[model samples]
Target: MFGKLYLIPVDLGHPSFEALFPTLNREITSTLTHFVVENQKSARRSLKLIFPEIKQGELSLLTLDKNTSELDLNPALDWLKSGKNVGVVSEAGVPSIADPGSLMVKLAHAQNIEVIPLIGPCSIFLALSASGLSGQSFVFHGYIPIDKAEKTRFIKEMEKATGRNQAQIFMETPYRNNQMLEDLLSVCKEDTLLCIACDLTLPNQYIKTQTIGKWKKLKTEDLHKRPCIFILGN
Candidate 1:
């Protein structure tokens, strides 16, 4: 029988993995000798933080990022084929959700390897739940365009879509967060409700929902280079 593929979630810019990852997840992650990771260096740091007892020497990590080719995954697939359980660890939060690792999951399914997702914090879901937005019908646009005109057009469309009782959820590169907020404030209507969820699950965690007009009027937190989730709702 082919070994199972476990989807493991890690901390989101915080070392408090104890609060986010459950015991089952820690147990599974600790037992795994093979892993497909976005960044091996960061993954090792996260592993040390989450499970200090984990033997780093025993681990075999394969790089699986945007540039990783289908041919690059042959070794990992071979490991699974040899009845060795492999874990998929993301840079932060859950794997394959606005993050890398989807291709491996798709291949594992095709190869009939059981895919098991261990419970952990998902920033998007946590933000939406706290944002008081329409979670029943929401869309997550991974990252908005870099060009100003394109982003403005994107946010305008998302706001228009939000008019239909749907919430538009999206993120920006940490450093570009403040700039994106400025665009939202400039392009969106004054009455359009905006939710800025920043530094989720951290001591300085900030999650607030306010009108674009109100947001402009208030002195906001330092979102520059902070991991954030921006949601547009009714």
Candidate 2:
């Protein structure tokens, strides 16, 4: 029989493993020596933090990022087929949601491997829960377009959908956060509800929802290097 595929969740900027993950999750992750990760360096660091007794050299890590191809993931599958339990972790948050680790999950299902999802922080759901938006019916548009014109159009369309009672959630690269905010203010209606959830699960975490008109009056600073989630509602 093939070993199960564990969908591991990492801290969302929390200080320690105990703070974000349950004891069971840590225990499961500790026993697994094989991991399919988005980034090797960060993955190793996270594993060490979760299981301090772990020997870094003993763990096997396979990179699965945007650039990873189906051919590149076969080796990781081979480990599962060999009866070694494998863990899938993202750079942050839950594996396979916004990250490319979904590919592995799909393959696991195809091969009849049991996939277990461990609980932890997920910025998308966390932000939605706090935003007081229509969580019952919502859509998560992963990342806004990089181009100015295209992003503006995308924001406007999401706003229209939100006005129809569907909550719209999206994110932007940390460095482009301020720029994205600027475009949002310029393109979205003045009375449209907007929520900005920044640095979630961190000490300086900020989450607020208000109309675009209200947000325009506030003295905004740079969110140039902070992880953020933006939600729109009517």
Candidate 3:
């Protein structure tokens, strides 16, 4: 008997949850046994929302702490030892990219467990599709710097990458998003095209593509305080 590992990435809060719940339930019915959630609270909250009929014996929900890098993989290690199926989930988006689940994934792979990643929404792809940039060649720079000097350096690097016709994508925490935008507008050339994909796949989802010149005149106060993906091109 082979054990299983499901990598479930939750994009939006409700809709993504709704879409994944049914599929996850079917897996449970088929003998899935362990779930590795970002945290205990998130695990319980998601289970209650998706599968209220969760049983104590059929599943083991391991809640990893916020400092995921420091999290001990002993639980997951033990589960693999028992030949039990394990599922990995992130708070939002796919697990392992920007989440702590990658560590577990590496460990599981070393043990030769079956790792299957389920289909789900990813902001990076969504932004790339709508950005009108070079999809064939793009680099996800992940989160950018918060400090002024570091942020400037990062932007310069991104501009250089974009000059090579590669779509450069990065994200910033919501509260600092506007400031980041301001910095981009100030530094990027007027003709530099930028795409801001906000609240993707949600009711208030916004995808706008424009040059630095155009964004400078737009009123940013109106944008909702939700996380957004920023894409830029030459």
Global lDDT scores for all candidate models: 0.92, 0.89, 0.76
Q: Backbone collision count in every prediction?
A: 0, 0, 0
Candidate 2 lDDT tens digits, 1-234: 899999988877766776688888878977999999999998887777777788888889999999998889999889999999999989999998877789999999999999999998899988999998898799999987888788888888999999778999998989989988999999989999999998888988899999999999997756889999999997
Residue-by-residue lDDT tens digits, candidate 1, 31-127? 8889999999999998887788999998999999999998999999999999999999999989999899999999999999999998888899999
Model 1, residue 57: distance off in Å is 0.9
Q: lDDT per residue, candidate 3, 1-234, as tens digits?
A: 557777766645555555444465545534555788886667655555545566645667776545655347777768777877787877776777656688788877887888888766677888899889889899997788888998998898898888889999998888778888889998888989999999877877889998999899877644436878999997
lDDT: the better of candidates 1 and 2: 1
Q: Estimate each model's TM-score.
A: 0.97, 0.96, 0.87
The C-alpha RMSD in Å for every predicted model, in order, reads 1.0, 1.2, 2.7
RMSD of 3: 2.7
lDDT of predicted model 3: 0.76
